[model samples]
Target: MASTHSTFKNALIAILATFPSILFYISFLHHHNNEDHSLWNWCNQHPFLLANVMFFLNVNVLFWFIALLQSSLHWMIGLYWMVIPVMLLHFYANHPMAQYNQLRSWIVTILTWIWSIRMLHSYLRRENWQLGVKQDWRYIDMSHQYGKNWWWISFFAIYISQQVLQMGICLPLHVVHSVDKPLNLLDFIATVICIAGVTIAFYADTQLRIFISKNQKLKQLGQPLVPILDKGLWCYSRHPNYFGEQMWWWGLALFGWNLGHSYIFIGAVLNSMCLGYVTMLVEENMVRENYRANAYNLYQKNTSMWIPWLIKSTSNDKGKKN
Candidate 1:
């Protein structure tokens, strides 16, 4: 349970976490296309059609954004954690036949809300907002943190556009989800895959946290944050954590696919593709940045980036040499 004193802090944390997301969305609609009247005009013409389309589109976009953002996870860790299960519950609730088992969907929604509540509460209590930095300094720092030398507007513009593309994946599933049928073997396999993927992600994250915390004491002594971690899961793949995460979303889509829904494939495929791209970019950049660190370079040379499949070095003569 959260302490009574933390209410204000919680509210502040919520704002900080949600602010960028909300603004990004607003800016997303504003800059994406020239016309701003799409929502209004659609609703004016046919309220029901507009509403359904909007809901469907938004949900798809949200799910895709959540998955991709989760893989990237720049600012809002709290939002990142809750977005997945909440999205799952949302898919369950807003599904067309959801009315038939509205109660079940609602149950899932409530559980998701609870999960969100717990995560948000923890973030507020634990986060060190670094409010002490000067405003200009903070802005410059954030530019480095969020924008990371990338153009801020363009980056988010691309990010939001990606969200739209990501959600587009669900259009097919939306069409098929209305069908009435018993579950099948494919469905079972998809579910298992989804569960395994998510579980692996969770495990990999847990391992990373342990790796970070192991060096926390070193950090307290005014040392820099550990530049590389090659222990535990890190030893296996430079980014087993990222690999696990990418698999999880793809797994979720597969689960949807097992339902024989094409829309679900859209959600999964786009997400996997985006993450796969980002993973390659980030890993390649890391290799260049840590070019001096022979160990890190060796790790990159030897291990797969987003795939667990180990890289076989034909150059067995190329041992770790300075």
Candidate 2:
């Protein structure tokens, strides 16, 4: 039984591992505050110049996309324990050479530590961990217990794997692009977008956490909170955070486009396709499963799918047709 539990924990950790790199890389790629790769003895020579070069990479939006992909995977891995550290290590090992740009790498290391610690906290505090022996069970069993309808664990794992593939696309490019050059307009824009996207995502997540936690307390008191959050940003769109997330990645992709890295283009295309599919297929299905057809149909009628805009329809017309 102990061995089985360990295996189950490892599997969960594997799924979680795919995301932390995205976070670290995104921060490393987009941060404008530092750019030198020098450390102790080795030097990038032109510290400010290298920093400025990275700043001009015009790949901020790409970083946003990567961050979203990683964080999403981390959320799923919340079911497991050991996988969290391992995931962080996986990215840490693959991190672009800090020797090439010590300043940038320093920022990356700091953010990596922060992300790892927070992810660890979230996992430890999760319901699965609190469940003791039951928490030791496999994701398959957990899904069945929740409602055998969608295989949520597998769906999450698939998305996490896709995120990993996107990260792999950058490995070769990062190696080749290691040589630094002068800054450009595109890099400046990427930096700005990266900052903006992170801010937006953080805001949306904060709002969501508050909304859910408040509702959970209300539920415990025998009052039901409406599943639909129709206040603040939620009022404008069913998925304000999703929109912010998409913007973050698309923005990063734009920055990569400026770098003229072919692999960057490849990674962007694949991630874009996956993001589209998630929005239309996986996410749509997941939402419907939880809220049921009628609620979702109504929400859809009045909410934009990816963007935050006014509702185009308010009729739950699809539900009626069905």
- The global C-alpha lDDT for each of the candidates, from Candidate 1 onward, is 0.47, 0.46
How many angstroms is residue 166 displaced in model 2 relative to the true structure, after the best TM-score fit? 4.6
lDDT of 2 at 158: 35
Residue-by-residue lDDT tens digits, candidate 2, 250-274: 5455444654554555655565566
> What is the lDDT, from 0 to 100, of the residue 41 in candidate 2?
17
| Model 1, total clashes | 3
Estimated TM-score for each candidate: 0.57, 0.52
Q: Whose lDDT is greatest here? A: 1
Candidate 1 lDDT for residue 317? 30
Tens digit per residue, CA lDDT, model 1, 1-322: 2343444553465345444434534453444343565644433444224334443444334433543443322333223444534543444334333322333223323433653554444333334333111222222444566664434442344435544553444332333233344555654564555455555555566666665676687678876555565545665576776666555556455544544565566666676686676676666655665522555577677766666654544343333321
Which lDDT value does model 1 have at 277? Answer: 67
